[model samples]
Each structure stands twice: as C-alpha cells, then as structure tokens.
Target: MAGPTTQEPVKTQQKCVAIFALLCCFAVLVVLIFSSVDIWGDNEDGITEENCSKNCRIVLVENIPDGLYLSMDGRRHLPLSVGFHELLDQAKHSVEVVSPVWDLNSWDVETMPSTAKQGQLLFQRLLSLKSHGVKLKIASSLNNSAELKTLAANSAEVHFVNMTALTKGGLHSSFWVVDRKHIYIGSADMDWRSLSKRKELGVMAYNCSCLALDLHRVFSFYWQLHERDYIPSIWSKRVTALYGKHAALELQLNATQATAYVSTSPDLFCPKDRTRDVDAIYQVIQSARTFIFISVTDYLPLVNRSFRGTTVTRYWSPIDEMIREAVVLKGVKVRLLISFWKKTHPLTFNFVTSLKSLCMQLHNCSLEVRFFSHREQKDDIQYGLNHNKYMVTDNTFYIGNHDWVGSEFAVNAGVGLVVRMTNSVKDKGMTILEHLKAVFERDWRSRYAKNL
Candidate 1:
C-alpha cells in the first residue's frame, strides 16, 4: 500500500471535529427545548389550546367476573380489555405504559386457565405494536420480569426504576398514555388477574391531549430515572405537570363541562405544579357535599419504615384525619368498602371501628364501613381480591393505583386522576361521577358486602 499523505490525516481530523460540533449543537437544542418555559404548552396566562381541548369523550371501564353480576342497569360500561385494545389500535406514533407488574402471559404454561386468555390476547396486541411502526416504551420496577425482557428484545424500549433503592418503595402505578392524546389510569395492573379474575376499574379518555400530555410527563420522569439510584435535585421542566389541582384542564366530557387533572404519589416524585396523591384524595373528600364513597383493597393508616437500621411504626394520619373531618365536621356521609382477603391487616379493623365510633352519638355524622368479600373456586388469595382503589363523591370522581395504606402514599410510586364535572347533573348522558357512584352502590348493596 502507498503511504498516506499528511493532508489526508488532517482531513479526517477536521471531519471528526465537525461531527463533534454537530452533536454538541443537537444536545444544546434538546436541552433548550425541554428547559424553556415558553416551550411545550403555551404560557399565555396558563390557559391555551396546547394543554386544553374541547369535546373530549371519557368512558368508564371495568372488569367484572361473569358470576359477579350486579343489578341490571341500562348503562353498561366498556370492558377493561376492550378499552386497552382500543387504545392499542388508536396509537399512531407512540404508546407509553407504566405498570408495576408485567405477567400478562400468566407464566406461559401450556395448561393455562381460561381466565388467562384475555391477558394473553392483550400481550400479543402489545407485541404487535412494533410491527405497525408504533413506538412502545414501558417503565416498571420489576427486576425479574421475563415478559419485559422479551419485549425489550423485540424492538420495545424498557426502563427500570429502582424504587426500592430510592424511597424503599415499589412502583405500583398502572397507566397508559397513547400518542400523547389518549390515556388510561386505573387500579388494574398489566397482569392476568387484573384482566379476568380480579375486579378492576379505570377511565379511558379519548381526544384529551391535554390530560394525556400531563400523564406523559409523568412517564418521562420515570423514563429519566432508568439507571439512576437517587433522584436528581433539580428536574427538567418537561417532566413537570402542565395541569394540576388548582389549574385543571377544562374540557367537555360526554357533552358536559368538566375539569380534570392527574396526581402522583409520594410527594418526592411530584415535581413542580404536580399534586400529591393524598392531597387529591383529600380534595375529593372535602368537596363532597352529600356523600363520599371510598373503595380500596387496603385501608391502614400506619407507616412502617426502617430508620437507621431499626423498624419503626407510626400512625400516618393525613387521610384518616381527612375522612374523620369530612364525616364529623363537614357533615358528609362517608361510606368505606374495604376488601376482605387473606392479606387483610389486623389494624384495618381497629381503624374501621374507630371511624365508626365518630358517628355513634352524633345525629349529623354518617360513617359506615363495609367489607367486600368474594368467593373463588380455587383457594388463591392473590387472584380473586377486589383490586379497586377509587373514591366517588356527589360531584367528583377519583381513580388511583395505590391502596388506602399509609405506606403506599408515603413511599410507593402511584398515580391518581380527579375529574370534577360542573354540569354533571344536567347532562343528558350519565356522567363518569354518576357511573362510578352507581357502581359503588351496586357493590355496597350486593350480598358480598358485610357491615362492620
């Protein structure tokens, strides 16, 4: 070979420098786009078309067992699996999902039960997203998730958040933000039980880009924490919420005016302009003038933590106090429907008794507690539990991922959605608030509910 000229080496060096400069410019542009206050949504007095939309349609989705039938109401909500499939089909560009569990295949056993069919179908649909040229990104805290690993190998992007190392918690959030326009937030996880065996409730909002954008910010927050063990001191504005409790997005749901916002758990995860999960729950309870119906799998107001090597247990009374105040001081009728399962904590009953005692001698106070029990053919405590975590009042409805446990609010990573309708009563169609209230009433009046 002939010897290379010195000018050729200089030309290669110049090309390398040019590429480096281009990359630097790209990085600076990305930073500016994310950190700029004038970017993303409009900042014209905090209300703009970028973060607010009209004529949005929101539907309530539920998963009830075939045997578990409530009274025949002409109104039947869409099934949860159907809702997920619709979102999958509507996704054009990207689909971002955050769930703690990813066992949709249900162990992939050859002799899988009939209940696993729905989950299996959903899993296949998720895998098909890549073939359609849609970007699929998933965030979870599960370390040994085989499904996630397989998906990651097949053109899906997966990120793991170390909740245990950061806050001694787990990622319990379950939501989907599709194409930055549609969203689903609820108690159901990406599991087989949530699809068929367990009871799940969620809301699917279509053509609501404002609310979906806010939820996508939350997903971005988790996506940024993929390989980090500690939270950053300062976060980029891109992950911050565009609409929160005070500045909710005004939209028309089923032809009725309503305000909606998304909330996250464990104050530490809530960036600027984001509302905490507990505060969201409190707002719903406080705004209830007539009644407050709460249904959760667990309702213990105690926080258990390891402090400097020793275990400490203390009463975390924010929500507990809020319920008591709503019942006694605000004269709001409070009804709690807690699930009774093998994992029911002993302290839960004691707190229920204490809450019941507040209305014992008072005439205005109305606090009632009920335990919802379900029977299954197989003795699997983990499968048949009522996995609902929501609160429906007279005007507002709140759907969340965390149970009413103090530790869940204190440390776990979850999300909550609050939608308050202004003209819910006068709307021709049944509002989401009324639908959830009816569902609660059905569960409350069913034979499975037992009074405390």
Candidate 2:
C-alpha cells in the first residue's frame, strides 16, 4: 500500500512536465503568428491596390560618376558642352524641382565653370519656371529658419515645418518627383555641399504608379500639416485602420505587387499605444535571403554595451537583435556601408566597436560590414557624412531617411517609399541590384583598394 501511494506522486510529476511542454509550444506558436504578420498595422496600405497594374519599372543607378558635376563655386554655371546641357535641360524641364533654397541672387553667372558650377543656373531656371506658372513647392526644416525666412521674404512661397516637432527627429529626406511619373530619392540635399562634399546615393524610377501615389499622399499629408501649422495627433492613420481586421488587412495586403510599410514615431503623434517601425525592419531582415545591403548614416544606437552602470541592461537592444537575426538564423549575406566621422556621440563609438565585434563573430557566418569615408581633396569633405538610408534585399528595395537604431521607445522619424519589383515587370530588381553592387564596389575600392 505504501509503494502505491509513492507511485501516484511520481505520475503527478510526469503530468506536470507534459503540461509545461505543451505550454511552451503554445507560446512559440503565438510568437510565430505575431512575427509572421505585420503586427503593428504599418503594412495596411500595402495590399489596398491588389488589382492595380504593375506598370512601373524601377531603374537602379549604383553610384553617380565622380565627374558628373552639377555645379561649381556657388554659382549658376551651366555646361558649355552639348551633351551636358541636354541632360541638364531634360532634368530641369521634366523634373519638378523642390528644395529648401533657390536663391537666384546668389548666382555668379560670369564664371564659365564646368557642369559642376551650375547650381545657380539650375536655381535660376527653376525660379523662372515659377514665374511662368509651373507648379513648384519648397518645404524646409525649421533648422534652416534664417534661410527659410529669407526665401519667404523673396516671394519663394516657402513652408517651414519643424520635423522634430512632427516626428521627434530631424528632416533628412531629399527627393523630387518628375512629371508625377518618376521619383528621385537620395542623400543629396539641394545645396552646394550635397553636390560635391557629401558621399551620397540616389535612385530614380520611371512609371511607378503605386509609389508615385503613395509619395503624393505622404507629401500632401505633410503639406496639409505644414499649412495649418498644426501637427496631427497621429502622423499615420493607415496603420490604425488595418490592424486586427482580417478583411481590411487582406484587402490591403493583396492590392499591389509591392508592399508598403510605414515607419513613424509615437512622440510626435499622440496615440493610446505607440507603434515603432523597427519591428517592420526586423521582419525585413528575417525575410532577406540572397543579400542584405544597408546604406546608413548611423548604424549604432545611442546606448552602448550590454549593461550600463547597474540598473540599465542593453542586452536586448535593437541593433543586437538585428545582428543576431540577420547573422545567426538567416544564414544570409549582410553588408553595411556606414559613414565614419569624428566628434560624433560617444555612444556611437561604442556601437561602432560593437558592430565590428559582431562582424568578427560572423566571419565564418557569411556576413561582412564595412565603414566608408568619402575621399576628397579638402579636409572638410571628410566630415560631410553619408546621410542616406536605404536597403536592398533580393529584388525588393527600401529607400528612407530614418536611421535604424536606439530602443523601441526611442523614435527617429523619416519618409520614403518601399517598392517590390519582379523580373517580368520592367527589370527593376536587376536595376537596383546592379546599382547597389556598383556603389558598394566603389566605396570598397576607395576605402581598401585605392592604390590598386
């Protein structure tokens, strides 16, 4: 009778272990479900146009040729050569140039400089178009308050919007729409420094209908807020509308050939529950297969090390999580080209070192990360910084100005478009891949193989 009682206790323990195993499986299933879908509702607009035609093809340009000078010496000088003028004229006519500054009085046209000295000339042409009634709008960051005021005084119709107020981060995206049919996105600002000082990259696309409309929507949203001088409580409603509703989500997900994911900061936008787009980036990292190429201005978070002091634990940082997922599980190739500059935040240094350590850890894991600095004759050029944020995966591309770093609670706002391409529809995939590869090669050569 004593032995029987002891056996009953042992059976109870076995049952407890079985139940624990079942609970673990259930937890795993829940995680898988959340991660598989765009849980934050950022992808709601991605599927709204499923029946929309895939009419646009993305053309990728790897690197702008060094000799491709658009201006020189802060003057409005155009190219004397026929081919240069032809291209310049085409861009001037076809592209609706939007910039923070277009000062005609600043142009010194007497200097017959090369194509590089045509900034003033370009500005003059754009301003002249405004006189003739070509629709053009200029939106500037509040940081350029002086310049904005000057332009507004000169009848430039400039709108001053504090991006930090709207998104908790500075404005950093430079783009132009051409004929409402093509979009140009890059790191180059509409300034002399962008043309010659900074190492920048931009992609131009033609006939991208869905992306064009999306861009228009974002621009219009910002423009509306800018006009009213009223920052919206929530910068994005597309996400709020699509989450938890399967039918709505399905409609959006199935609408277009390419998916769109919106990234915003909760600090600027008032919401009951804040949503961060880093989660979308994590999903992208996990889905990457062939290659992952990142062109970022800053790759490290503001906080460094696994633990700071005693109470702070940075073990689960976003950068760490990204590295682990991209390198450990995916078996995917990773390449990062980040700008290196002196006098940056101390935490950046630690993050850079951490990145280096991660790269070393992945030495046998098929991951490569490299830091890049632009090589120019002037010492000041080194400090110009690479302020572009873009990523290309297999055939998909993401172009934005948001730096992916910091905590889920920290918000860095940016605006850009994500477009998916296939081989059949205009060969945008190949174009992007080729462009990214070329840029990477050029930077690599400049950094490591300059003498070669």
Candidate 3:
C-alpha cells in the first residue's frame, strides 16, 4: 500500500511539471509569431515620429484669378500650377494623390481652351511620373472620368472610393504625398477650374516626413476601401493616424517652431487615434485669444440626411454656438468672409444675419460678416470665384477641404491641417498665420466684399 501511494504522488508531480513546460512553449511561440509579423506598420526605412528630423520648410501656394486681384501686400506667392509642378519634379520614388474629381482634361470642348492648358500639362506630368520608374497611386470617388481611365492604362494605380455608398455623401479630400517626405494640402482639386480660374489656397511642406506619414495613412485608408461597400470592422495599423490633436508633431516650420496635426471627417472613417474634423475646429475656436478670421465657400448650420428612404434634417449648431460664445462670452473678435457665387445657399444670408445680431446691443462684442462676390467678364459659371477654405486666428492657422456645413462634417470625407506657431517667432519671411491673416484682411476690405 505504501509503495502504491508513493508512486501515485510522484506521478502527479510529473503531470504538473509537464503542464508548466507546455505553457512556456506556448508563450515563446506567441512572442515569435508577433515578432515576425508587422502588426505595428513600422516605416520602411525604420523612421518614427520621435527620431525623424523636424526641420520642415513650408510655403503658401495660391492661385489668383487671371483678372481679379486683391491689393493687400506686394508679396508674390507661389502659384498653384508652379507648386504642383515643383512637387512632381521633386518626386523620386512614389507619388500618392487623393482628390474628389479627376476632370483635368476638358473632354467636352472641341478646341482646348487656354484656361485648361495648365491642367492638361499637370495631367501629362503625372502620367510621366510612372515612366520615370516612380510609382503613382490615386484615390478618388469618380467612376467615369476619362482622365482617370487614361492614367490607369498608363501604369497608374487608380482606386475608387464609393463615397455615396459608404457615407451617403462624396469624398472632398485633396492632397498629395510624395516619397513619404513631402506633402501638399489645400482647397484645389484635379480640375481645370482649380488649376487656372478658381481662387485656391493651400500649403506645401518639404522634408516633413513626420507630418507626411500621418497624411499618408489617410490615403492608405481610402486606398484599402476601393471596392468595399461597408466600413471594415477591424482596421490594419497601417491606416491608423500616427499623430492627432492630443499628440501633435512638434517641428520647425520655416525656422519657426510649431506644432501641427491632421484631422479627418466622418467618424466611421476615422481609425485608431485620428481626430475628427469637427473636434479640430472646436479646438481652434476655443483656443483663440483675440481674433478669428474665417473664409469658406459656404456656412450653414444644418444637416440633411436620408434615412430609411426618408429625408431628415437637423440643426447642427456646434460651430455656430462656438462662434457666438467666442464673441459674446469670451469677448473675442470674429470676422467671416463667405463666398457669394451662383450656387450660394439661400439660407446662408439668414445665418449671417443671426450671427451679426449677436453683437447688436452688447458691449465688447465684435462680429462682422462679408460676402465676397466675384463676377467675370465672360460669365463663366465655374471660374473667377474665391474657393478658399481656411481659418486664421491670432496664433493658429487651419487649412481644410470642407466648407462650414454640418452635412460636410457628418458624412463627407475630408482632411484638415492645424498649425500653431508662437507669436514671438519673427523670421524674415512671414509665417503661415501672418500670411493668411494678411490675405483675409485684404479680401475683407476689398470692394468685392459686401456687408450683411
């Protein structure tokens, strides 16, 4: 009996030892699997936001109308066409572009108009990129664009994002990422009007891989949703944002130290760590200490949605409320310059009037609204308009692709760049905030602007 009991205890001890050894093996296997797999989407060159160089050179690019000119300052800005060409010229490895439309070639016209020559040239240069052993990738929601078709046939990888199917809206994001080091973010699209006739404003950053990488993740997100009709339940880390409002990248832009970050719209489209467009705008407005200058094509505090085959509308008052608080409560001065074109919203005037009434009988409250009307001699419907979508405060500047519409923030896919600089950094050239503020003041005081 003693012998049997002693043997039983030893057998039990051996079983316990076996289980412990198996657990160790399992842990080792898990570590090896995760180590070999790319779960974090590390940079190809092993560059991270922490170790990457931050001395980024930034330039403000604008496209003024052929005839209309705003007399603000004598400084000449780099034209939009020249900026795009420079980006193409500097490309070595790859170029990724995201635009809502691809109507660069005016296929409807028999004789190519002079206005479209710049666009055609840009399209040709983009095509030549693939021939130079440089990869070209494009993301757009346009399905039947002849320009996109032609480019795709000639070594360009074009991916379609079904915006309507995904968000009941369209993609209005426009930007470019080159070689994972340079970027261009602005209000211009890949259309002829944007290149030649429309008044557009944007920024170009060179050697800003820290910021470029974050924007590239946005492009990668759209690229991965080419044929999918629904948002993915799980997202790859490759499409996740590297920096957001909570953790903006600190960089020396134009020899001035600043903090910058990128934000995206449509909450469903934002993956891990991406800031929402509405939230970004709120932060900018809330942080303003003195004055806020806003220029957008449209501003309406309403959202129209279609649900269950029925149309529904709601009052979206986040931005509107912020502006009122800034003026009435915080005593911050605010100026709004809205574009007045053929397609201007009828309800826009009503909203402007309401905003102006906030300061009717109050002290220390200043709010002004102006409509920028641009009329061309030829009466071209699409040209000769102020298409700027940006805002500049005392120390912050925001450049984005969406108009100040509630629907734009609720459903559309767009991107915004926020740059905050110290007021003490006074270099030879003007910083972005100063340049944009000057541009705003020039337009606000011009004859084209009319009081509400």
Q: Candidate 2's residue-wise lDDT over 75-145, tens digit each?
A: 22221222122323434323333343333232433442343344455455555544544445565555445
- Indicate the TM-score of model 3: 0.90
User: How would you encode candidate 1's per-residue C-alpha lDDT over 1-452 as one tens digit per residue?
Assistant: 34567678888999999999999999988877666543433222242345555668888999886667667477778999999999998998889999988888866544655756898899898899998999899998987889999889889999889998889999999999888789999989898878887888999999887787788889988988897899876677677788888998888888888998999988889988999998898888889999999999999999999999998999999999999999989899999999998889999999999999999879988899999888765655255567899999998999999999999989999999999988744456577788899999988998888997
Q: What lDDT tens digits, residue by residue, belong to model 3 across residues 163-274? A: 9889988889999999888999999999878887788999999999899888988998898789779987666667778888898888899889899999999898899899
TM-score of each: 0.88, 0.63, 0.90
User: By the TM-score metric, which is better: model 1 or model 3?
Assistant: 3
Ordered from best to worst TM-score, the candidate numbers read 3, 1, 2
Cα lDDT of candidate 3 equals: 0.87
TM-score of 1: 0.88
| Model 2 ranges with Cα > 4 A deviation | 1-54, 61-116, 143-156, 164-168, 227-230, 234-277, 303-316, 343-349, 356-364, 375-387, 405-412, 422-429, 448-452
* lDDT ranking, high to low: 3, 1, 2
